[model samples]
Structures are given as C-alpha cells and as structure tokens.
Target: MMRRLSGLLLSLCLFPVPAFAQSKPCTVSDHPEYTNKIKEFTTESFFSTELVDHLPLSSCVPPPDAFLHHIIGAPDTLDYTKDINAYFRLLASKSPRVKVWSIGTSEEGREMLVAAVSDEANFAKLDRYKEITARLADPRGLSEAEAQKLIAEGKPMYWADGSIHSPETGAPEMLMELAYRLAVEDTPFIQKIRNDSIILITPIVEVDGHDRMVDIYLQHKKHPDKPPYPLIWWGHYVSHDNNRDNLGVTLALSRNMLKTYLEFHPTVMHDLHESVPYLYIMTGTGPYNAWLDPIVISEWQEMAYHEIEEMTKRGVIGVWTHGFYDGWAPNYLLSIANNHNSIGRFYETFGNGGADTRVRTLRPSETSREWYRPNPPLPKVKWSARDNINMQQSAILFGMNNVASNGQKFLSNFYLKSKRAVAKARTEGPVAWVFPADDSRPAEQASLLNLFVLQGVEVHRTERELRLRATESGRDPDAHKEKSAEMSAEKSAGKSPDDAKSKEEKKPAETVIRAGSYVVRMDQPYSRMADMVLDKQYYNVSDPRPYDDTGWTLGALRNVKRRAHAQSRQNRCSRRHRRPGQNLPHPAQYRQHARDFAFPPRFRSHGSRGRFLRSRRPEI
Candidate 1:
C-alpha cells in the first residue's frame, strides 16, 4: 500500500494533466438566446425562487472534486479558480482535437497549465495539408474540408484567459461560459468554431495565487454563499495578491515557462487581472484602447467591447471597458513591458493584448479604488494615445518600426564589424550591438567609443549601481589587460577614424539585457555597459506593462535630456554613471559602473512638452 501510494503521487506529478482533467460535464444551450434563458431564471419572476433553489452549490464544499466548479454559501465573490479549471476540463472532454499542459509552478506552487486546441487527426495527415486547406474555402461549399484553411491563414481565433491577480475574479468566472460553449461536441457554436479556428488557452495565468484565493473562500463563506460571494478567502497569502509580476524567488520558474510559451509565438496574449472600484465606476480593463493600436483600435473596440457592453445591458455585471473605469491591463503592460501584453505583440504574434474588466461588477455607489483608474478624460485620452507610446516600447521586446521578424540575421554583424574595427586599430576587438532607444544608448551616443571589455555579462542585477556587461572569455585579467589597453588607446585618441569603417562599426555600440543580439554596444565612452531593469512591471502590478530595469515611463521622459549630466539630474527614476564620452580608465569597475539609459532620437522633443504632454497620455 505504501509503494502504491508513492507510485500514485509520482504518477500524478509526472503525468501530463489529461485533456478531460480541466473540466466536467455541462449542459449548454445557444448563448445567443442567453437573454431569454436568463430571463426565466431572474429573481423577479414568479418561478425565480424555484429556479434559484435548483442552482448548483457543490463548489462550496471542501471544494467540488474536478467537476462542480463552485457553490455559493452566504454572499461574497464567485469561485473564479474552480470555475475556470472546471470549465477548461469540460473543453478537453468534448473536443477530440485539444491537448493541454501545465507549464510552470506558481507563487503558491500550483500547476500553471495551458491548452492547445487544434485538429490533431487532420494535422497528422501531412500529405493532405494543402488539399485540406483548399477544401475549407471551396467555392461550391461542398468540399469536405474541416477548418484547415482558417488554421493555415491564421484568422483571428480568440484565446483569452484571466485572473493573474486572484481577487480580480470575474474574468476566470466569465471564461466558464466561454468554455461551456466550446467544449460540448453537439453544439452548433462549438462545431463552427472548431471548423473555423484552433484555439489555445492558459485559463489561470496565475494559478498558484488564484488557488490560494479559491481555497480560502472554500474554507469560509462557501459552505456556510449567495448569488455573489465577496471578501473571498480572507485568509491565504495576502502578500501574493497582485503578483502577476515575477517575484525574486520565482525568477527561474517565470523565465522557463515564458520561454516555452514563446515557442508557440501566439497571435494574441491576454494578461488578466482584477480592477479596483470607487476610482473607476463605469467600466474596467478591456480591448484595444486608442493608446495601443489606432488602425485596428476601432475594430477591436467594436468586436470585444460592443459584445461586452451588450452583456452589461443585461444583468451581467462588470463586462466592458470605458471612461468610468477604463483601466486597461493590456494597455499598461504593452506600454512598458514592450507590447508582450499589447494587441500587436504579434511578432510574438499579432492581436495579442488580452485583458479583463471590472466595469459593472461593483455596486453602483460602492468603491473598490485599489486599481489605478485615471480620471474620465485622462483614461480616454490614454486609450487614444497608447498606440504611439506602445509603438515606441515595441522596439525593446523586438525592435522599432512595428516590424516583426524572427531568425538570426545580425549576431555576426556586430562581431564582424568589431573585428574589423579592432584589426584596423590592430587592437583586440570589442563587439557590441547598438540601439537608438536603450537607456544605455545615450552613453554610447555621440562619442569616443569605449571597449565593452572581456568580462562575463552579468544577466542579473539587484541595484541600479551594479549592472551586467558582455564578456567574451573567462575571468583572466592579463588577456583583458591587453585588450583593454588597445581599446583604451582607441578612445583616448581624440578623433574617430575618418574611414567609414562599415557603419556597423562606426554607428554607436551597445550592450543588451533580456534578449536580442543586434545594435548593442559598450557605453558611449566607457567599457562599462548599461543594464536593463527587466522586472519593472512584475514588481508593480499597479501598472502591468512590460519593461526591463532600463525602462522608464514616457511620463518620466518629460524631465529627461539626451546628455548624461542632464538625464541623471532630470529623471528621478534614472541613475547616472558619467558624461557621455567618459571612458573607464580601469577594467575592474566596468560591471559596477555600467548603467542602463534611454535617450531615443524621438526623445529630442519636437519643440516642447506643452503640446506633447496632453497629446501622448496613454501607451497605445
């Protein structure tokens, strides 16, 4: 019995969560008729009492085993975690084409999983790929094609999940309704979706934190709830609240899981979280605000918010995003995190920014102002300006110009250029990719270039003073001394080589944090490199945007100047190393001296902030 018990534990741990494990059986009718069906179950109707009495409440227990998502006990918040997982399980059960995997451990060590829904049988038949696709769009409408064409063409098949923050529970709960529609085999809607697009889901983006909330609710009010369950799970890890960002302890876990997710290069990324009340009365997080993508902003607004607003017209609370509380999770994330949380994060895949809303969820007069809701005009303005600000940020996750391309094209470009430049100086080469946008880019700006040096790159940094720089070889001082000497002389010489030594060499150099190999170099004049503060957004969920240590809010840009002396003094968030063109005389201080900076050419204010400030409030 002991051996068998241990074996069972091992099996559960190692075994991939089977598709059916995400949900249980459920009866779903056409949701388009949702209004009529719900009307029959309203509290005001004569038979409302009978209908209410029959409603399921099994989740209120020690928590329903994989099936019944939740059962309200008194009156609080809904069980978002249970509902989301259970609903996903149902999706797995009815759909033969889907597969799911729990990718990482959460803050509470819960299994964070994802579902890949595609036609496996069709995909298996390699020879039929083209034929199958052609048939889906057959002019005669009689070709026996499944949804292969839609799959190939990459039409928008929405993939959204929620609650990176546990208490912002509505999104995961709402996902249940979406899951029920897609999972059942017999439903016309389910069939149509499967025949049209392959869907992927990571239902509980923050499973560990979410479960902590769910467990507390289950322990208290649930067994002992009503139509609504508030103050959910008063116990549990309160510190874990709003932990959508990577905690210092969980760095490895976040890195690995995110890397795996990147393999799929998803077209859309929905980072769900709850919204605060009081500050935002009208609506909550939502689809494309004008701040992120202007061209398709209106389209997304129509497709998502229109449907969401209609849901609001009914009894459904907290459905859409607008002026009252248009606090958008995706918008904030994409702005600073560099589009990984925004709509056009498509190089990662387009149409990605996925977020949630707390619009009508709160009582009309009540206030849950924990969320950062800008005033009416500000949020709307931010929504509109987001596209431009976010486009500026996109350069970091990928590059500038909203152009997305993958594959190695420029790794050797810097190395080759540096090698030639060093050969001409006949000095050991200091190779680096440069950028016009990175914070450190300013140091490398307009100057006598310093050698990046031969020290190991420190990928991690705890403070602004201590940064990482690229190192070509192991820790051997003599070898570095030789290289540093030549490199130092190259900089000490007042004049840059008049020869147009390949702009790759002549253009300023930079050092990159996170990933990407091109356009990086040593600080403008010193061997010291700039460090990217990668976890800015993770540390503060108040603004769930993506960014590295080097990142700053454009809100911060107003005080900044292109020159080193001016920037460190002007920008509060910024740290200074030295004036641009200040070369490091010593090799040992390179790591400690390197600092991340930002002074994009765009930063050169076109005239002044009087107009710019009002024009670019949001990060679209």
Candidate 2:
C-alpha cells in the first residue's frame, strides 16, 4: 500500500495527469427490494461496521482526584499551572509508561514541561529512538549502511503542543486527559501506539499566559456586568503573535520548542489551538498552501481524511474541512515542521469562554436574517466546557491512531521527501546562496548566521576570498518582478529589449566571497527548507491569497551582501566553522573597540564614550 501510494505521488510529480471526464457509478436505492438488487450495496456500505468492531476497545478510568472533576464542581476556572503540573507529576511518579521533563522556563518564571508517553519498554530506551530520528533527518554524519540501520530502528515521534495562545483554552485540558488515557489504558490500540511510536505532549506552551488567562476568567465570573478580557500574550516581548516566531526564534519559548522539535525530529507534529472553530484541521480552509511539497501534502491529506472518516462513523459532529486557515505562513510552528519534511498539522477546536462557561456563539449550521448579519450568518448556540474537552479529545485520539497505524510509512515518507529535496537541489537549482560576511556590521552578520544555525541549515565558511558568479539586482521575487515591470513598461513605450536596459545592468557581477562568508549549499538534506527561507519564493497572491508574506529572505533582511552562485568549478568545501558568535564582534562591542582605539568612524552613542574611556583596554 505504501509503495503504491509512493509510486502514485512520484508519477504525479514527474508527469501530471490532466482533467478527465467520468461517468457516474450505479447508485444504491433506499427501497428494501433495491438493496437485494444492488449486489455491491449493503447497510454498512458508507462506513464499515466490521472495522469499528475490530477496533481496540477500552474502558475509561477516571483518576480518583481528577483535576477535571475539581474544575467542574468549582465556581470558577482555576490556575492550570498548579493543577496541571501536580496532575502530570503525579502520573509520571506512578506510571512507568509516562515520563515528564521541564523543557524550559517561561518568561514569567514558570516551567514549561513536555511529557513522553509510551509503552514501558519504549520509555526505557526513549533516547535511542530520539537519536535515530535525528540522524535520519540530517544523514550528513551517517553512512548509507548506518542510515539504513537507524531507519529500521526509528519509531515515529508525534508532537502535540497546546495553549500557545491563552484564549484557545481546550488543548491544555484535552492533553491532560489524553496523557492519562495513554498511560493508564491497556487497550491493544493504545498499546500499539506506545509500542510503535513515541508521543511528545507539551500540555501548555505558554505557561505565563495560561495563568494570566485563568486569573482573568475567575475575575470575570465574579462581576458579570464587567466585560471579559481573556486574551493575553504568549510572550512578554511579543504579545499574541509569539507563535509567529519560528523564523526569527528570538523568544525563549520558540527557542525551547525548536530545540525539542529538532531533537526528536517528530514525523508528525500538531500545534493545537481554538479558533473560529466550525471544526477545521491544519492543511487549511482552502487548497493546501502552494509552498508545501505536493507529495507531503498528499500524504497528510490521506492521514487526516482517514481520521475524519473514523470520527464521522463514530458520530462525532461538526468536524469540518475547508472553511478557514491557510497554510502559507511558514513562520507558524506547524508550517516550520512541514518545511522540515514532517507532517505538521494544526488542530482548531471550537472555543468557549475561558472557564468553559456556556457562551452564546454561532454554530456553522445556524443563519440569521437580521440586517446586520452577513453571509453564512451564524445564529447563537451555547457551547459548554464539556463539549470543548470532548472535541479536543477526539482530535488527539484520531491523531494518535493515524501515527500508530502509519508509523513506518510516515518514517519512509519523511526520508523519501528529503531525498527528493536533495535531488531537486542537485539537478535543478543554482549552486548555492552565498551571504558575504560584512566586516563592518559584524553583529548583524553574526546574528544572521546564528539564525541559520537555529533553522538547522548546514553552513560552510570560505577558506580564502574567491570570485563567484552572482546576481546583481534583487534578493526577493517581488523585487525581481518590479525590475522586470519597469523594463517591460520601457519596452512597451517603443524601446528595444536591449535598449530597455543598459549593457552594464544586463550583465551578472562577480562577488568576492570573503574568508568568513557563510555558504548554504544545495544538495544538503535540508536544502529545500534552506532555499525556502533564504531564496525569493514566488506566490500567486492575486488568485488564492497567501496567509502572510510570499517571500521571506533572511539574507536580504540583515543587509548582508547576497549572491546567487552557480556551481563553482573549484571545490567549495573548506574547514568547518561552527562558532558564529565567537567569530564576529557584537555592535556594542564594536563601539567599545572603536572608543578604546580612538577610531575615525563615529559611534552610535556619545554617553558610552566616557564610561568606555575610563575602562579602556586593548581591543581584540
């Protein structure tokens, strides 16, 4: 089945099939005599009852002092940090299947935790599994034989993180319950998941915001007349947009999450949230984002649709596809994972009020005739805490089942897609992108290099200055488009194509690659992702709109001299330079160095000179 799917995808990529007309299949009749007349039809045709019967059955056991129980009986929402930590800690302390680690500290002095839940045996050797996944992802340091060995040993790791946004309340609670079920339930399906895969669950990504939200909700209940202010920032530095820091990775939370993401190299990852729910999954409200590789999107859709089908068969209501959310923004953590050749899914459940209080909100089916009501006018429906919890639980269950059932295929797809990326870079693209290290702006150069390192892009430094083939004008697609537009307008106004641009402007320039210049080459395993981040990506925003910016060139942003290099006749590899910060001086350090040496260049600040002069030392 996996081979068939892989072949189909490869064929589609190599030779796309055009639209073909098809005739409708014979239909089954509801009439009793018609059931017998249609041999292919039966009562269980739409959904196989036999498959559901064969599913691993289990009993749900509520913990004696479950936090959900306490929350239900309590008058107001409670601080999740205290209760959540206590619950997970207790579970880990008691169950061999569960292990908890504090991944990092949040902005407001709270611990961010990730719980690893697997079978007891897998939990014992979890580090081995993590290492295998990491090696498989990069493969630079591994021999072909060694890579094959690791691939055989590797188990798919599925990551799901919650509550990155404060108001998206369902995920944290659902994760707690899911953790309990995975740890306690001895069902064959749960056991298979534990045995075949490792589940990484970060119950709350934004610890500070969660506590703040709880406070706001508890306070709001006390004064019903006062308006509720449930929304709070995930980061102290950048408000609700902290989740959009995958590219920059400046915030501590994003840094921590990236560390785990790269470490485990999860085959599938989920960033859980509550939006204008109407039940939507990650690949979004429209066609899958154009930037994503088609093969991966095909695999992801297969996995998601299967789960949705199962959910529907079991009578889970309002599970929708294609309504909201576009997957264009790569800065989103989920899309970041997708760029890394993993199946990254976004789970958006309908959100109620902060404390799971019943609130008047619009259901998808509801409509209104009021003058103020717009198209698809949603009428009010009361949503409760219980419904939110159940929906979230359903999402986790479907996701886990998907991974458990398709673990090997997921692993194969990840490896194959990466291989395709490497192939594309080697056979198709320009040699590499060279960011010439700016000696004058050492700090900014160092910052940019560090960003590349954070993004897991392999980097090389030149041993000596060398002239390489380089583009002159623009670094982004839009810039190139603008340049072409200007030339086109000139040509349209009766100017010859050659006369439209001067000979000097038409020719490519040779850029001198400095000794410390960073080289991100094609042919590396993560070349596609590196290209996406560093190169100019074109988007058809006029048609199906992108969620965010189409082109994001980190090289262009830092004011570094960027050059598109063709394959060098001479070998480009040189001695590896890993330490970016040590090689370059920071801007402040540059000023301090300038002051001590009494340099001719003017510094950014004058007040610093007095203090620097008092503590003058020999500049490096």
Candidate that scores best on TM-score: 2
Per-residue lDDT tens digits for candidate 2, residues 1-620, read 99999556434422212211224422222232212322222112221222221211122223413334442212245546756765676666555667787777887788888888888788777878876776566554456677666777778888888888887766776677677667765567677788888888998888888887887877787887998874645458476787788888767688678766766778888888886543455556444545466777777667667666666666554555544566566787676678777888877766764645454667544343222112232355445554555556666677787788777777877877766665554466645766665655555565665666566665676777766555421233335656788877887898776675575486657556676567766656666776777666556646476566565777666655565555544644455543211222345655566444322222122111111001111100
The segments of candidate 1 whose C-alpha lies over 4 angstroms from its true place after superposition are: 1-66, 69-94, 118-152, 155-157, 173-177, 222-257, 272-293, 308-320, 324-620
RMSD of 2: 15.8
Model 1, residue 298: displacement in angstroms? 3.5
Name the weakest run of 10 consecutive residues (lDDT summed) in model 2. Answer: 611-620
Which candidate leads in lDDT? 2
Instruction: Kindly provide the TM-score of model 1 when superposed on the true structure, using C-alpha atoms.
Output: 0.43
TM-score of 2: 0.76
Give the Å error, residue 31, model 2: 44
Error of 1 at 97 (Å): 3.1
Q: Where is model 2 more than 4 Å wrong at Cα?
A: 1-76, 141-149, 229-234, 285-291, 359-380, 438-440, 469-511, 579-620
After superposition of all CA atoms, the RMSD between model 1 and the true structure is 17.9
